[model samples]
Structures are given as C-alpha cells and as structure tokens.
Target: MEQRSVGDIEGPWIEPEFDSNLIRRCRENWAVSIGQVANGVLATFIRQRVGLSIVVPEAKCRIEARYDDDSEMYDGELAAALADLS
Candidate 1:
C-alpha cells in the first residue's frame, strides 16, 4: 500500500494556510483510536472468538464522531473505555 500523510488527504479542505499543528494532532488521535480498536478486537477474539464484523461498526461510530468535530466526546469515550480496561 502507498503511504499518505493526513495533511495530504485533508490539506485541500483546510482554509487559508495549512496547519501543521492540526495535522500532527489529527495523526496522533488517529493512531490512538486505531490502537484502541486493535486492543478491543484482540481481547474480544481471545475471550469470545468474535471477529471484525463486531468491532468494525463500533470503530466506525468512533471515527464518525471524530470527523463530526465531536472529538471531545470521542476522547471522553476513549478515556472511559480505557479506564474500564484498567
């Protein structure tokens, strides 16, 4: 697969100047979300033998929330989920 930065994908829509800080923050949040989803899938697999069909919708919801500019909600959900895991 070809590699692409978040800025390359989102830069066009961003008004005026490209914000490197926004790109960096987006990249960081994306990674964190992916990691959380991966961990959830692994745990479900080990415990219930469930697969991606179960996890993908949940991930989609989270991603949609982030794209909807509701990242504070996403972050709170993520933090609460992590707290549950701990």
Candidate 2:
C-alpha cells in the first residue's frame, strides 16, 4: 500500500476563506492509500472481507482503495493485522 498525506493530494489550492476547523478536521480524520488489485471481484472481496470502510474505483486491472479512518487513524496495528487477514 502507498500512503499519502491529505496535503499532498489537496495541494495548496484551497481557498483562503475555507474554514480552518474544517481543514483541521479533514487532516485529522482522513487517510489516503493507493493500491492495485487483480480485478473488480478481488477488490470487492477485499472490501467485504476486510470490513474497513473503503471505496474501490472501477478498473479493469488496477484499482485504488480508499480506506476511511474509523479508528480515528490511531490504530495502525489493528489495521495492519486486518489487512494481513485480507
């Protein structure tokens, strides 16, 4: 899995008027990772089996799985263990 920080993805284009609290919330609550699976079926299986909140983009061979931080992004060990299971 390749992980990226929110700032890396969003860049510096955010409007100046954007709420600081909202930006902080996003930084605190979200994590982004990119990975490729064999196909849609395998991707779906992983999503269901892992039980982590994820979004799998449609693709023939490569897919991006976006994992939502339900554990407040602090449970890396748990996430790693579950990922190994899947």
Candidate 3:
C-alpha cells in the first residue's frame, strides 16, 4: 500500500457530484465542518492496516473581522486538544 500523510488528501469527506456548488460555497466561507462518517471508518482502516498517525492542527481565523461578517473565530480549543494528544 502506498503511504499517505493526512495532508496528502483533501478534506475528510466525499460528497455527491451535484453538491459541488454547496461544497464550493462552504469552502469559500470556511464554514465547512471537519470530517464525516466515512472519514471515521477510513481512519480506522488506516490505523489497523497502515499504522499511520493522524495529526489535526488547530483552526484559526485568517481574515480579521471587517464588519459583522467575520467575527466568529476559533478559540484554539481544538488545537490545544490535538497538541495534548500528541
């Protein structure tokens, strides 16, 4: 089997082809949730068969709030949890 890093793939889910517009819109706004049900199964397979470790980094806001549109930001809890896991 070919070795793969976690970053080697796109986001941890697959969507229907027709949902491209929705996917694009979510990516544009950064409101997409991480992972999916299939991702969990895939991760289990990778762990058992490939013995690879996954590292999920912290998500932070890149753009500052220009108005009322971009104020919501990551509080670093996810990042800190990942760090602690490592």
Candidate 4:
C-alpha cells in the first residue's frame, strides 16, 4: 500500500477532479465544521485504523491521518480532519 504523509494535507485537500469552483465553495462550508468533526469524528476513525495516526501539533496547524484509502467515506472524513487542523 502507498502511504502519504500527514504533513501534505496541511495546505489544501486538492480536489481529485479538475474543477475548482465547487471545491472552493464546499471547502468554505467544511472549514466551518472542521473543528467540530476533526477532533471527534476524524480522530476516532484514525485511531481505529491499523497504521494511521492523527497528530495535531501545538506549533503548526497540520493534521496527519494515515490509513486505508478504500475505507468507507474516506475522503469526507479526511477532509474533515484536514479542515480541523488549523
């Protein structure tokens, strides 16, 4: 399996597709709820996973969540985690 570092998500969760307008609009909404879900929902998901860890450093606004990309609702959960970071 391929593993991506948590640091990479610190910036933007680049939309898989080529569009940006919808992504930007959706991200705005996600940014608002990140705090509520990231700490609770996202953390739980990461914790349950085998090789994944979600770390929120006090110094930097970076959230690292490593796990199976094929899991259920994986992208949504990850987006929540990334939003929660900062």
Q: Which portions of model 3 miss their true places by more than 4 Å? A: 1-74
Q: Whole-model lDDT for model 4 versus the true structure?
A: 0.37
lDDT of 2 by residue, 22-68 (tens): 44444333343333222332333333342133322222113134433
Task: Residues 45-68, candidate 1: write the lDDT tens digits.
Answer: 223322333333454464446533
The sequence of per-residue lDDT tens digits that candidate 3 reaches over residues 1-86 is 22343334444434456765434433332222223212332322232232223323112121122112222233433333334444
Better of 1 and 3 by lDDT: 1
lDDT of 4 at 19: 57
Over 4 Å off in model 2, which ranges? 13-15, 18-21, 28-86
- Pairs that collide in candidate 2 are none
Instruction: Write down the lDDT of every candidate, Cα atoms only.
Output: 0.37, 0.35, 0.31, 0.37
Superposition TM-score, candidate 3 onto the true structure: 0.20
Worst 10 residues of 3 by lDDT: 58-67
For candidate 4, the TM-score is 0.22
In model 1, pairs of residues that clash are none
CA shift at 16, candidate 2, in angstroms? Answer: 3.3
Error of 3 at 40 (Å): 16
Per-candidate TM-score against the hidden true structure: 0.22, 0.24, 0.20, 0.22
Q: Enumerate clash totals for all models, in the order shown.
A: 0, 0, 0, 0
Query: Which one wins on TM-score?
Result: 2
